[model samples]
Target: MAAKAFQPRHQSVSRGIAFRLVSVGCYSVMAALLKLASEHGVVAGEMLFYRAIFALPVVLVWALRSGGVRALTTRRPWAHLGRCALGIAAILCSFQALIMLPLATATTVGFTAPIFATVLSVLFLGERAGNHHWLAVALGLVGVAIIMLPGGPANDTAPLPGVAVALLAALGTASVVTVVRQLRHSEHVAAIVFWFFASSALVGGILLLYVGKQHDLQTLAILAGAGFAAGIMQITLTESLHATQVSILAPLDYLQIVGALALGWLVFSELPGQSAILGGCLIISSGIYLIWREYRPQTIARRNLEANTV
Candidate 1:
């Protein structure tokens, strides 16, 4: 009887694990395709255009299934606009970084988003922080330094501009996370997601006019595939959250570095440098510590509330 009672939760956790794995794979595929597309003369702007336009149908279906027409409506237009704008910029920066650096290097650098989010929460949300916050931030910087400093992993290996762009992308991504926290108070999740896709498509369309050109059929197919992968990544990622606590699933995200390293090696003959490995370790450790610090209080408070109710 006790075993039966635990089955449902076990199933939910299993689903979370499955969905998270698929989400990671989809993201890796998208990144690889984007990188490949770039190699074929596809500009970052054009890739954005295709990715946004193609991802629309998938996002729309998910939105409708979740909330119907109501999901498309939002009371916070300005907030959505801000999120979409930031997302677009971050995505473009990521694409550009992929062009300039090896996949593993870019992936490792991109992991700084959580650290950035922590800082943003302290600055904008006025969230109080303790020693862990400083330690986490410091570790993050050190990891970046190892990758960017002379004789470090990137030591004249990858372009300096690429590293800078990747860091900016991480900051932009963190800003999006901060904005989403505010939006969650007044907006529907479905609305927030749907509108972002719509906005991306719109922005991509405008950019397309300026940078679009004819491409080989193979390149076009890859771009389309990248867009589909992005939507699938979003869908699976959402499902994973619905099934389990995000903190439970987020640590698995580091697996992406491994996949990126493998893919980059297989496809482009790119190898992970010593700095990349060492720096990635520091950043990852800091990120996990931050996640633990962020969640521990909530877990404790919930337990306290449950005990009080009993």
Candidate 2:
């Protein structure tokens, strides 16, 4: 009976890992497509508009499939709005960084989101950080500093503006994560996902009036692919979280850096400098350790028990 029971859990975990890998792959491809679109003269705002617009149908379909239209309904409209706003900012900054910086550099810097999230949680969520957490955060920041050091091996004419924007994106992402943590208390996942696309579409549409530019067929195709990939990434990530403990999924997020590096080399003929590689290693190590600490066996057991009860 014990072995039989364990089999299903093992299968679920395997499926979750697969889904998370697919999610990371999708996001990497989407970033590459967005970068291609930018090369063809598509501005960030237009890309955002198309991405959000094309993603809406997918999000809606998913929401309906999950629980009909009622699943999209939410009492926390303002919270959704705030989440969307921050998300849009993060997207815009990230898109700009994708165009302006090398893929590896941009991705390495953006990986600092978790570090920023930890600090923000302490400040805003009134969460107490233990010594281990602080050490992890400090190490992660050091990693970021190494990557950002001017004229470092990784600094191959990487524009200061692009680096700054990438950091801003990381900060925005951290903020969004913090907000979503709060929203989970009262909002459904479907509602949060739906509102984000809707609000992004609205915001992107308005911004298009000023920053939009003409695109050829190739650029249009790339934009559409980016949008589709974004939608798939979001859905797969959600499904992965549902199937496995977040701690199990968190480390998999680092797989994105591998994907980013591979895509960068294959598509853009770009390579990361020594600094970037070293810093990326640090960031990944710190993040994995932090996640390990946060989700130790006891904590996982408690969470599992609570989840079962709920």
Global local distance difference test of model 2:
0.84
How many clashing residue pairs are found in candidate 1? 0
Question: What clash pairs does model 1 have?
Answer: none
Listed in order, each prediction's TM-score against the native is: 0.92, 0.92
Candidate 2 per-residue C-alpha lDDT over 218-243 given as tens digits, one digit per residue, 9 for 90 to 100: 88888889999999999888888767
* Candidate 1 positional error at 308, Å: 15
Candidate 1 off by > 4 Å: 1-11, 297-310
> Local error of candidate 1 at 18, Å?
0.9
